[model samples]
Target chain A: MQLAVLILEDERPVREALARDLGHFGGHVRIEVAEDVPDAWAVIDELDRDGDRLALVLADHRLPGTSGVDFLVLLLDDPRTVHTRKVLVTGQADQQDTIRAVNDAGLDRYIPKPWNPDELRSVVRDQLTDHVIEHRLDPLPHLQALDAARVMPLLRTRGDR
Target chain B: MPTDVHHPRSTLPRPTHLQLAGLVVGLIAFLVPLLVDIPGLEPAGQRMLAIFLLAIVLWVTEAVPLVATAMLVILLEVLMISDQALVALPEDVLAASDYFAALADPVIVLFLGGFLIADGAAKFDLDRNLAAVMLRPFAGNARRSVLGLMLITAMLSMFVSNTATTATMFAVVIPILAVLPAGPARTGLALAIPVAANVGGIGTPVGSPPNAIALGALEARGEGVSFLGWMLLAVPLMVVVLLFAWWLLTRRYIAPDTPMALDLSSSFDRSPAAIVFYVVAGATVLLWLTEPLHGISSSTVGFVPVVALLATQVMGGDDIKALQWPVLWLVAGGIALGAGIGATGLDTWLLGLVAWEALPLTLLVLLLVAVGLGLSTVISNSATANLLVPLSLSLATGLPIDATAIGVIVALACALAMALPISTPPNAVAYATGEVDTRAMATNGLLVGGFGAVLLATVLPRVWDRLGLL
Candidate 1:
C-alpha cells in the first residue's frame, strides 16, 4: 500500500506554501495538513479509527506550547502508530535532543526551519523509503508497526534523499 | 615496606625522631641565618638564601599559614644579627603595626568597595540570578555547554575578584553538576570557572589585587593609567585565554557527551531582577573607568557610603549589616602589613641588596620585575607592591633610572604575576573552587608566569625608555 505525508505547522503562509508545494507530487503521495500539534492529534485520533498508516510526519520543533522533541517522544509512546518517520522542522532544535531521539524514538530525519520546499519532498521521500525498506522489507506485516516518532532530525535524510 | 603496605590510611604512624631531625635541619636552613648572629655570613647573602629556601619550603609543606610564614622573615631585624643584620628603624619591624597608613589607603578602600559590591550582589542573589538565566537556555551538549559556562564565568570575573567570582558561580554550579550527564561538559565548567575567573579578573582593576597595586602606585606618582589603557591590555588577553582554552579544550577532550543541568531557566525568568544586575555592573565599569577623569579615585568615590546607600536601596540595611567583615578586615590588615614594611625601611633595604649601576638598565628593570612578580606568589600582591614600590623609588637614589617606571612595573608585576594562591585574590578563589587541585593550579600558573614575564620584559623597557623612566 502507498503511504501518506502529514505537515503540521502554525504559520498559515508556511503551511499553505508547503501544502501547495507538495501538491506537485500528485495524489499518489497523499499529503495531509494540520496547523498544530492539537490539530495533528485530532487527525491522528481520526486515523486511529481507520487504520491508515502515516508514511512520514514532518513536524515543527516549536509549536503553540509543545516542543517537537517532546511531541515526538509522546507519539513514540503510543502503541497504535507503527513505522512513522518523524522529521523535526525548526531553526532552534536542541541538537543534543535531536541526537538522543534518533537513538530512543527511531527519528528518521528532520526538515529544518525555513526549509527548502524541493528539499523537504526529497527528505520525506528518502526517509519514508529508508524506514520502510530497513524495517518493512522483510515482509512481516507485524514488523511494519514500529514508530519513528522519537527519531531526531539530525539522523534524517541526506544520501537517502 | 610490607608493613607499610598494610597500614590503614588515617592511622599511619607519626614520623620518627630521625625524620623530625631532617625537618628540623630544613627549618634551620631558613631560620639560623635570620636569628643567629653568625660571624662573616653576610646577612644579605644569608637572607637571600633564606628567602629562596623559604619559597621552596612553603611550596612543599604548605601547612604553615602562608602569611605567617611570610611574616616570620621579619626576624632578620628582630634578632639583630651583627654587621650582617638588616638595619631596622626605631619605630617598628613587624610591619603589621603600620595598620594606620594602610587603612587610610584609597586602594584598600577601593578593595573595600569592590568587596561590598560583590557582597551585595551575593545578598541580593544577583550572581545566582545571572547564572540561572544564562545557563538555563544552553543545550547541555559538550561543546555548546562548555562555551556557555566559559562565557558566564569570564564575564563574572570581570567585576568580582576571580576568587569571589568563582565562589559565587560555584554555589550555582555545584547543584547543577549532578544533573549533567557526566563527561567533558562537567569537566569543562569545572576547569573554566577558575581559569576564567583568574583570566577574566584582568579586565577590571578592582577585580584583582595586582591591577589595583599597579594603578594605585601609578596614581600615587600622578601618572596613573586611564581605564581605556588598562582595558586594551587586559581585555584582549582575557578573551584570548577564555576562547582559546575553555571552548577548544572541551571540543577536543569532551565533545559528543550531552550533559544536562537543573533547568535554571525558571528561577531567573524575571526581567526586572536581571536588569538591576546589568545596571549595577554597568555602573561599576563606568565608575572605575572614569576615575582618571575625576580628581578622586572611584574607590574613594565614597567607596563605603555609596555601597551603603546602594545596599539599602537595592537589598536593604538588614542585608547591608551582614556584609563579609572578616574579609574586609583581613584586607585592611594586609594593607597595614604593607605600611608596616614601608615604615621600617625594610622595603628600602630590600632595594639595597639589588642596587648597582654595574648592571644595564633594561636588564635591571626586567630583573626587578621578575623578582617582584616572583615574590608575590608567596607574599600577597599588596605587600609585594608595598615592599617593591618603595624599593623602586629607592632605586632612583642618585641613579638615572626612572622611579615612576620602576614603581609602575613593580606594581604591575605584583598584580600580574598570579603565580600562587597567596599572591592574588583570584588565585586564592581559584584554589578555593575545590574542583582544582592545588598542584594543578600552581603548575598552570607557570604558564601565566612565563607569559606575563615575557610581556613585561618586552613592552616595559620600551615604554620606560619613551616615558624617560629608564
Candidate 2:
C-alpha cells in the first residue's frame, strides 16, 4: 500500500514550498497539500478509499475555523489514522497551543517557520522510518524514502523468515 | 479494509460545543413559535421571529460556517413560511424565490465592487504607493509620524477590510518600530495602525462590513445614503476619533523628539493594466460620489470595477476565488433577516411594544447608540451592526427623527467599539504582534472608545439636521 504525507497549511506559498521540498519522495509516497482542516480530511478520505495508509501529517497550527491542534486531536480518535505521525509546522503557535499539541495530540515534532529545507526533509525521513518500523510494514518496498540503516535489521529478519 | 476506511461516522469529526449550542438554539427557536402565544402577533411573524433568533444565535456563536448559516436562514425562512404550513399567512407575503433575490442585493454588489477595487490595488501595489506618498509629510517628526501612520492606515481601511489594512500597515511600521528603543513608543506605534484602521473603517460605505450593513438596512427601507453623504458625515467623525486615539496613544507611550527619516519612494507599477485599474477606480469613486447627478445607484456603479478588473486582467481567477465570500454571505444574511423582519410584520409588532414616541428624540438616539457601543465591545462589530441597525430603523419609524440618522449613528457606534481584541479585527491584529499587551490595549481602547461615543452622540444630531437628513 502507498503511504500518504499530508501538508495542512493555509498559506498558498508555504503549502507549495513544503510540497516542493518533499517532492523527492513523490514517486513512492503520496504527497498531498490541504489549505485547511476540512480539506485535510477530504485528502484523508481519498487516500483511504484508494487503500493508502496515512503515515504522516504536517499541519499549521492556525486555520480558518478549526485549528491544526484540534484536527490532530480528532485524528487520535479515528481508528484508521490513530498511528499517523503528526508534526506541527507553524510560526505562530502560542505556548498554550504548543503545549496542547505536545500533550494531547502526541505531536512528534515542531518545525518553526524559516526552517532549513534539509532539516525538513530529514525530519520527514526520520518520521517515515519510525512509522515503517512501528507498523511492521515491509521496508524494502519503501526503502528509498526510509532510513536505510534503521530498517535494514527488519529487512534482514524478514529475509530470514 | 473498505469497510474500515469508509466508516462514515468515524470519518466525520465529532460535534464541538459551538455546534451543539447552535443546534440547541435552532431547536429552541423553531419550537418557541409553536409553544408560545403572543397577543397581536401573527403566526407568520412568529415564524420569522424564530428564524431571526436562530440566525442571530448562530452568527454570534459562530457555530456553523457563516455562509452556511446564511444559507440556513434562507432555507428555514422558505420552509417555515411555506403556504402549506399552519402558519402560512398569504401567497404574496413572501415568494419562495425572493429569498434567493437577497443574494443579489445592490448593497452586496456594492461591497463586491469594493473588494475588487481593494484586490486590484493590492495586485499592483497601488495601496502601498499611496500609503508611502501620504506618509512622506510626517516622516521626520515623532508625534506626526504616529499621525501619519494612523492616517494612512485609516484611509486604506476605508476601502479594504480593516484586518488587511492593519496587516499591510504593520509591515510598513515594523522597521520603524525596530529602530526605536523597546518601550511604550514602539508599543504606541504598533497600536496606532490598528486603532486608525478601526476608526477609519467608518468613513465610507465600503469602509467596513458594519457600514455596508447599515447601508443595506437603509436601502431595504427605501431610504439610502449616498456614498458622498456617508463620507460627509463619517469622514469628519473619523478624523475626530483618530485624533483622540492618536493623542491617547502618544501620551501613554510618549516617543522621543528624534526626527527619523523614512524612504517614501514607491516601486509602484506603471503598467497598462495598473493604469487601467487606476482609471476605473477613479471613475467608480466619482460615480459613487456624484450618484445624484449621474442617476446611477452606487450598486450599479459597483459593476464597473468588477468588469474592468476582469477585462484588464488586473485581478485573476485565483484572486477572485480568494475574495472574502463569507463576509458577503454574512452581509446577505443580515439583509435577508431584515427583509424577513419587515415581511412578517415583526418590525412593526416589536416597535408597537416599545413606546418610542413618548421618549425624546435625543434620549432615544443616545440609548440606541449606547446599546450599540456596549454590544459591539463584546461581540463582533459586524454582528452587532447586523442585529442593531435594522432594529434601530424599525424603532425610528413614525418618530420625529429620520431612521437613516439613527442607523448611521449605530453603525458608527459599532465601529467605535474597540476596547477589547474581540471587539474588532484590527484590534486583534494589533494584539497578535506581541508588542501590545491586553491591559494596555483595553485601557487605551476604552478611553478612545468612550470619548468617541460621546463625540458621535453630540455631533451626529446637529450635523444630520444641517445635512437635511433629519
Candidate 3:
C-alpha cells in the first residue's frame, strides 16, 4: 500500500502545475490530481479501492460551488480523510474561511498563491512526515519523501527484531 | 479529536508461497518423529523432536511472526512434553512452569535493564548529544571522522540495540552526507554505521538478542558468563573486526582529502530528572563493569536500575509498558526450546546422528561458526541462536571443549552475518537511506563478515584459551 497526495483545484493549469512540482515524489508516493471537489472524492474512492492511504490533500481555497474550506470541514466528518493532513494553497481565502480551515478542518499548512517550489516541497515533506509520525507508520518505504532525521526515533523503537 | 470512525482496519495478509510450503512441511516434520518409532529415542524425545522440527520450519519461513513462533514453542513444550503433557510420559517430567520460566530467565531480566537504559538514553537525547561530544576529537579528516563514527556507533550499540544505533548515527550523519559530494564517500559513510553496529553487538551480553540467548542457554547448563566475562570473551574480536571494517570501507570508498567534518555541538539534558537518570545510569554501568568487584550477577545489577528509575520517578509506568516485550518474549521462546531439548534427551538423540568426534575439534568449531554465520545471513540472528545454541551446547557435551566457548562462538557468528540488507535490522536501516545500494552493501558486508568469520573460527578460540576466558 502507498501513501497518496491529492491535489484538488478548479483550474486545469493550477492542477497540472501542482502535480508537476510534486513530480519528484511521484514514484515514492501516489500523486492524484482532481479538477474539483467531485473529482477529488472520486480520487479518494479510487485510492481506498486500491489500498492507498490519503495521507495529505493540497486544495485551493477557491473552488466553483463548494469552497475548499467547506470540503476541508467535510473531511473532518469523513473517516477516510479525518487523519489526512490538510493544506490550503490559494491567496483568495478570506480571514473567516482561513479561520474555519484552521479551527474546523485542522489545516496543516497554507501555501500563499505565489509560493517557492522549494518551500512548497518542504511544506509537503513536513506535513507528510507529521502524518506518518502521528499515526506511527513505518517510515522505511517512504523514507525518501520524509525528513530522514526526524523519523530516526520511530526507527529506534523497532529494536533488532 | 476526531475518533477514527472509519479507521482502515488492515486487510488480512495473504500468505506467500513460502509460508504455505512451511505450514505443510512443518506439519509433516512435526508428525514424522511422533508417528515413526526410532530405535534409541524415548517418547519424550520423539515429542521434542516434533516441536523442534516445527520450530525450525516456522522460524525459517516465518510462516508466523518470529515472536509467535517463539510463543508457540513454549506452549507446545508445556502441552506436549512437560509433566502436564496430554499423553503421560513414564520418564521424569519437568513442571510446565519450568517452560514458562524462560520468559523471566535472568538473562531476559538483564536485557530488560539494557533496553530500558538504552530507551532512557534516547528518551533524554543523551545518545545523540554524546555522539556529538565524543565525535569532537575526530571531527576534521574524513577517515578519522568515519573512525570516530564507527567507534561511537559500536560503543552505543554495545548498550543500545544495533538497529537503534544505526538509526541514531544516521540521523547525525544524514546532514553530513548532504554536504559531501555524493559518491563513494557517501556510500562509505552510509556503510559505516551498520557494520559498526552489527560487529559491536558482540561486545556485550545485552548488546543483542543472540548474546542473551547464548548466555541464557549456557546458564541453563550451569555455565554462566558474567557481564564483564562476556566482554572479555567477545570485545577483542569486536574491536579487531571493527577496525578491519573501517580500513576496508575507507580504502574502498572514502578519499583522505574528502571534505567531511562532523558537527560537534551538544547540549546535554540537565534537568533534575535528567541528573537523577545520569547517576542511576552511571551507577548501573559501573556496577555492570565492576561485577567482578561487587560479585552481583549481571541480571540483578540489571534489575536495580529498573527499580531505582521507577522509584525516583525518572521513568514511569508508561516506560515499562513501552519496553520491547516482543524481543524479550522471543528470547524466552528460545530459552524454553533449549530447556525442553536438553531436558527430554532430544539433543543427545540428535547429536548421535553425527559422528562429531571423528571430525577434528577446530574443523568442528569452524563448521559451527560457518553454519551460524550463513544461516543468520538470511534469517533473524536471534532465531539462528535460538536453534543453534542448544544443539551446539549439547554437541560440546560429548567433545573435550569448553561449552561456553562453543555457545559464545555461535552467538558471535550469528552477529557477524551482516552480508545482505535482510541480514539484520541495522542493515535494513542503512539500506533504506538510498546511499548504499545492494552492490555496495553486499561487497562491504561480505568482506567484513568474511574477515570476522575467519578470525572467529580460527583465531578467537585460541585467543580465548590463552586469555583463560573460557
Candidate 4:
C-alpha cells in the first residue's frame, strides 16, 4: 500500500528539501506540509480520517510557531497521531536535552541538521523498511487493535504514566 | 503528558490591575526603610526590603517604566533624611553644574566605550558564534555544557551590560541545554547563567550600576581610576568568582572532548570597534597615571577618556548611539547624592563621630568595607555608595591613606555584595531565572564577597599604594 507522510517544519527551505527527498520512497509517497502546530494538527486529523498511512513525521525543533518539542508533547497526547513514527530534526546539534523528550515521546530518530544528505537518505530508508515489515505482519489473522502499541514502550516513562 | 505551568497556584488572588501593583510597589519602596531602620532587624533585612520592593515592581508591573520607578528613588533619598541644606536649591530645578556634571562623569565614557565594543561585537554575531563553537565540544555532557556557558557569559559581560550578557548567554545555552541528553547540566545552566551574569558584570563599570557609582566617586575625588587599573582589579575578582559559581552550581561530569566544527571566519573576528574601545580605555589610563597629561589639572583628566571616545566615533566612524540614557541619569542622580553628602558636610560630621585616631588605616579600610557591604544589603549599590563614598573620601583626606584608592574599594564593595538576591541586578536576574535558588547564591555569594573584600582591602590598596595612588 502507498504511504503518506507529513512534514511539520517552520523553515521553508528545510520543509521543501525534505519533501523532495521523500519522493524517492517509490510506493507513491504522498507528501503534505504544515508550517506549525495548528496546521499540522488539522492535517494529522484529516489524514487519520482518510485512513491514509501516516508513516512519519519529520519535525524541526526550533519552529517559528510552536516549539517542536511542545508540538510533539501535544501530538503524543492525542491517540490519533500516536501511530505515526515521530522523528526530530534539528539544526542546533548542541541540544542534548532532546533525548529525554525523544524517549518519552517514542521518537524513532533525531536528524541533526547541516545534515549529511546520504545519512538522511539511509535513515529514511531504514525507517521505511521497518514500517513495511510491521504492516506486512499485520496483513492477516493475529493482530490486536494495536496501532500505536508497538511504539508505546518508547513513550512509557518511569515515575509517571 | 500534561504541560507544566511555571507558577504554582496559590489562594492569594492576583491583583486586579497593573496600577494596583504599581501603587503597592511604590508605597513599599517608600515605606520600607523606615520600617526596617527602626531597630531589631539587621541592615541586610532593610536592604532586602528595598530590593524586594524593586524586584516586585519590576516583575509585577509592566506599566511602570523601570527608569521612572528608579528615579523615584530620589523621593526615598529625600525622605531618608530631614537635615535641611544650608542653602537649598529649588526642588525640580537643578543648579547648572549639577545637570552638567552628568555629562562629564568618566562612568558615562566607560559605558559609551563598552556599548561601542559590544555593539560592534553584536554586528559580528559574537555570542551566536561563540555558542556554536563552545557548545559543540560539550555536545552531550551536562557538566561541560554549564562550564561552557559560564566562560562565554563572563567574557561577553566584560563588554556588554550584564543584563544583556545574561539574556544573550541564556538564549544561546537554552537551545544547547534543551538538546542535551537528560541530566543535571540543564539544571546547572538554569542556575549558573544568572550568577555568572552577576559576577561577569563586575568586570566593567558599564556592566553594573555600583561600578559606575564607585568609578564616579573615584573620578570626583581627583583619583580617577584608570581603565587598565580597573581591569587589573575586575579581572581577578570576576574570574575567580565565576569558577566558584560553577563549582557551587553543578556536580555533573563531562564526556570526552569532541572536535569542534567551527563555521566562523577569522577575518575581523574581533571587531575593529575594539580599536575605538582601546583608544578610549588607553586615554583613561594615561590620565589616571602620569596625572598631568592634560593642560589643566589631573582632576580634569576624567574628561580625557570622554573626549577620546567622542573623537573616535566622529573621526573613526564607530556608532555611539546605543548609550543608555536612563542609566546615565541614574548614575548622575547617584553622583549627586554622593556629592551632596560631601557638600552637606554630612561626610565630615559622620567621619568625626568615628574615632579615626583610635584605629590604624588598614583597620579603617576594613571597617569601611564592613559598612559598605552592610549598607548595600539594604539599599541599592548606587545608594550604598552614595551614602558611604563621601564619608570615606572625608575620612581618607584627614587620615594618612589615599582616600581615592579607598573610594575604588568602596565602589567594588558595592558591586561585591553577593549575600542578598536584591543587592545587585545580576543576583536578582539570576534568582529570577528559576534555576538557581537564593540559598545557593547566598552561600556562594558570601564566599565570593569575602574574597572580593579581601582583594580590595588588602591586595588592591597595597598595589594602588605602590602605584602612587596612596
Q: In terms of DockQ, which candidate is strongest?
A: 3
Q: Alpha-carbon error at A50 in model 1, in Å?
A: 76
Most lDDT-accurate candidate? 3
What are the C-alpha RMSDs, in order, of all predicted structures?
20.8, 14.2, 1.5, 15.9
B396-433 per-residue lDDT for model 1 (tens digits): 55467555556555655665555565555545543443
| Clash pairs, model 4 backbone | A95-B179, A95-B180, A96-B179, A96-B180, A96-B181, A97-B179, A97-B180, B47-B378
lDDT of each: 0.56, 0.81, 0.93, 0.58
lDDT of 2 by residue, B354-462 (tens): 7889888778878887888888887767777877887889887778777888889999999888888777766765665556888988888888888988878877679
lDDT of 2 by residue, A1-161 (tens): 78889999999999999999999988878899999998999998898888788999999999999999999988987877889999999999999999999998899999999789999999999999999999788664575687654653342121000
lDDT of 3 by residue, B418-451 (tens): 8899999988988888889998899889899999
Query: lDDT, candidate 1, residue B404?
Result: 50
Where does candidate 3 stray beyond 4 Å? B1-10
After superposing the true interface residues, what Cα RMSD does each candidate give? Answer: 25.4, 22.5, 1.4, 20.6
Off by over 4 Å in 1: A1-161, B1-99, B132-141, B175-185, B213-233, B256-284, B292-294, B302-349, B355-445, B459-470
Model 2 clash pairs are none
Q: What digit string (tens of lDDT, one per residue) describes model 3 on residues A1-161?
A: 79999999988988888989999988889999988899889999999899789999999988988899899999878778889999999999999999999998889899998878899999999999999999999998888888999998898888785
Instruction: Write the number of the candidate with greater DockQ, choosing between 1 and 4.
Output: 4
Candidate with best TM-score: 3
